[model samples]
Target: NVYYADFDKILLEVCVGKNRLKTERTDIYTNIRHFGRTTKKGYSFKAVIPVDKINGRDKIYFEYTYGEAKVRTSITFLSFQSRLSNKLPESYWIFGNSILSYDEKKKQMIVEPLTFGSHLKHEIKMMYRVARHGRKRIGKKKTLEMLRLRASIKLNRGFGRKDNDSISGAPKNKKPVWITYDQLFKGGDNGQYFYEYMNKNVSDIETCYIINKDTKEYKELTRKYDRKTVLPFSTYKTRLKCLKSDMLFATRIDIRLYMGFTENDEIYVRDLFKADVVCLQHGLTIQKIAQYQNKFYDNTKHYFCVSPKEVENITKPIYGYTNDMITLTGAPRYDGLVGEPKKQILITPTWRRNVTAGTNEKGKQHEYSVNFKRTTYYQIYNSLINDKRLIAAAKKTGYRIVYLVHPILSPQADDFDKNDFVDIVPGVKANYEKMLKESALMVTDYSGIQFDFAYMRRPLVYFHPAELPPQYAEEDTGFGPICRTNDELIDELIKAMQSDCRLEDSYKDNINNFFPYDDQSACKRVYEAALKITNFS
Candidate 1:
């Protein structure tokens, strides 16, 4: 059974008996045997039933209690060996409302729920299939075929024919159609900077920037560029443009946002769109991420790197990227991280998994609002921001604290305690480039934004109340001194303020070593690399 963590308790009672013969009754405690949480924000549990006590005549009754509600379910016992014997013909199993489709060659079953919406109750179905003969992973061709079938149905219903025609009605040109986006809803990342560079420097190729229509960045961009060049994300026009694109550039590897596809459709849609993908990268590759490996990004033709160390990290056996795939170009956003900073301390922290329920394919925040404040992430940061010592230190140093909540945690922005000296800013609405340039010092907890701050040679303080290990241990990445407590963070801030928020000499050397290019020419290098990949150079 799968349930939210908010449930008071969950228990399973199994009764096995018939009309004439009575058998043993078992009460299984689900918490003792945990299968961990599912990706959809629900805890899964396995009940251990004694199969030896059951007979063919016995009726298996299963009852589970969640919150104040009690639900009774029944299941038939089927031996694993019997199922693998190939005695049963190819069949579709309907467990509750979900339909499980089994693939014989792949030896896997995909469970799809028949009902939709939050009020629908569903059952958990588990099917284990072991391949008798060695078979490769399921091919993407079948998935793409299904996606195209669905898309054709939608098109027949008059969905996107006009938009498709508008995008494909371009004059003949040798250059490829380039599509770039960053976070979909916002701009000012490497993708946006690269798009702007292409529009300014390279005129022969077609370029389109995808952004959310409701965003302030969209309004700003529409005013600056023609409407045809700036396309709203998840729209019919953007989806058609993605299908027609020859080159795709993004900070995130999830390319479904531009095509208005769900998370489940990412693999299929990536295979559907035949384009050379260039990873602009959201941040420096300091921490190890399994998804960034070569197998996951098979369509990626070029991966932008900031320094040799980052290139080395990606080329490692774990990441599995060849040396030729990496383009040694700094992030394009770094070119705009220039300006005289004011006497303000920026507090930016990354999001925690406990605080958010989950995100949709479009990257919208779905928060667990009811228990958001109860999380350790909220309580620790809320207390730290409102701490009198930190507040007084900022006041004494004549520096204001601007607490920028992560975009994923933006839904719970108001949950934090309000203070006089600190101003809470939602990440979605805030201009990150502006904040990065105007801040004197930054206080963060495992955020890649620290690299942006460090690029300006400014002082930074890492608040690690959880005592998380640094991403890079073998060598310094030129990050600030880590503070394990609120008091320690305040002390570090005070010290930084005393020295006029200047970066340490040792850290300066490390920063120079970390970034291969700091000449504000990252856009140029990235543009050249893109041209080379597309054979435009």
Candidate 2:
């Protein structure tokens, strides 16, 4: 509703993986073709392909094109970039759609979205090309279906709905959902806190608390993926248990605010069967790249689109769901960071190696050469773990040092030692609310940490290690300085930590536009939407 924005037309540019066509007719058109599975009439959103000619080879495309005859795409690469700005809400900007491209007729090349990667250009182009027909139809909706199919497989493999006798033993409460995270260890792994918090936060509402499933012994979160433990990965058996669960509490409607997650995780599919299922993903650029992997749920009840900004112009094209589907509820994990963002500083470097694609038993796949600048948990940890300067400040200034390790590096305590100066807190399953409540400041690079920190409106010092390859930058982007060495880390961390009330002065304007957590009613907005969708009262 702003005057200037109303007149500001979205800028449409066309650029791509080596313009295969003549420089002339490369105009990026808003007109687009929908890529539906089966007979192909199904197209979620449209996009203006900014390219010469979508060759049959390349996997992705970007920028803009030239010409009137230039494929007038509705929600193509051009439109998404034109409307969305950086720093959109993490939950709103979801990376979706994994199929290469639907032949608009043949029906084939159905694949899952690449939930954990940073090759947007590569994903987009390949998705468009491989989807040329009769190959394997992978649409956003299909990815979701794939999840259900996985669960169905689980049913066949044994993990089915709780037996009638088991249901009869229910604790007077028909709570139909079950969740288990290996990370939470508050009450000596007994999961006593579940009852405590459930009672306090959601008590006497006919609920059952049973976490730390294997707490009879000491099994730390991330100890090792055990099917016998809590919830395992999206395996065949896991799916069945998830599917047969009562639809009312099928899943938590996981609205991931940060980046990186399986497009077809069991939880996502479980939500599909439930009446009130919804997913909150972030990023226009991220979502489009992930398009190929998630085309399955292109037209499902549970599937929805919710990114940081709603990026208005582009999101409207693909996400047909109402604004309710797009709750601006920042993120439950980030709820504590709003308004009271810290003035002090804490360092949280990015963690890589653990999440490598080809990383197998032998070790992380070291062959593939990435195209961006990236730093790993091992590298960053070693570089600054014993840094004399960092230690001195933590001890002297009481800088409140906490290392927020990515999920991959979390369980492996054998790799690094956590001393008095450093506390290794895994980003996964680790309650971010606790981190935000205790700390006054945070420092992180890439990895969805920025989005979580931004909600707090705290001063974040981005440490850009020069040792990392430039291609890593494609992994993530947020405003701040780049620290290349231990010395730079000290200076930045010191300044950020020492400052008492400089956050509002230094990061005020940017935080306002980026996070905008000024109001605490985001949860209310999200809750109401969920109520209307499921009529849950």
- Model number with the top lDDT: 1
Per-residue alpha-carbon lDDT of model 1 for 1-537, expressed as tens digits? 343455336555555443122222221222222344224322223334443544433344556666777765433212211111222223333223333333444343334433332112211111111121111223354344434533542243221112222111222134578888888766778878887887888888888888788888788888877678888876656766676577778678656655565443332222224456678888877565634434234345678888787787777654545788889988888888889999888999887665677554473546547788878888888988898977887888788889999887788899898989999999877889999899998988778888888878887887777543334333435566877887788788878877779888887787787776777889889888887876666
Expressed as tens digits, the lDDT of each residue in 304-419 for candidate 2 is: 22235533422343434344334454443333344444323455555565334334321121233242114364556655765777777666766656776555454443355567
Cα distance off (Å), candidate 2, residue 205: 8.1
* Colliding pairs, model 1: none
lDDT of 2 at 151: 40
Off by over 4 Å in 2: 1-212, 215-276, 281-289, 292-324, 336-345, 353-377, 417-420, 425-431, 469-479, 484-486, 504-506, 519-523
TM-score of each model, in listed order: 0.67, 0.48
Q: What is the lDDT of residue 325 in candidate 1?
A: 82
For residue 523, model 2's alpha carbon misses the true position, in angstroms, by 4.1
Output the TM-score of candidate 2.
0.48
Cα deviation at 222, candidate 1, in Å, is: 1.5
Q: Positional deviation of 160 in candidate 2, in angstroms?
A: 24
Model 1: lDDT equals 0.64
Please, what is the whole-model Cα lDDT of each candidate in the order they appear?
A: 0.64, 0.38
Q: Best-fitting candidate, measured by TM-score? A: 1
User: What is the RMSD of candidate 2?
Assistant: 15.7
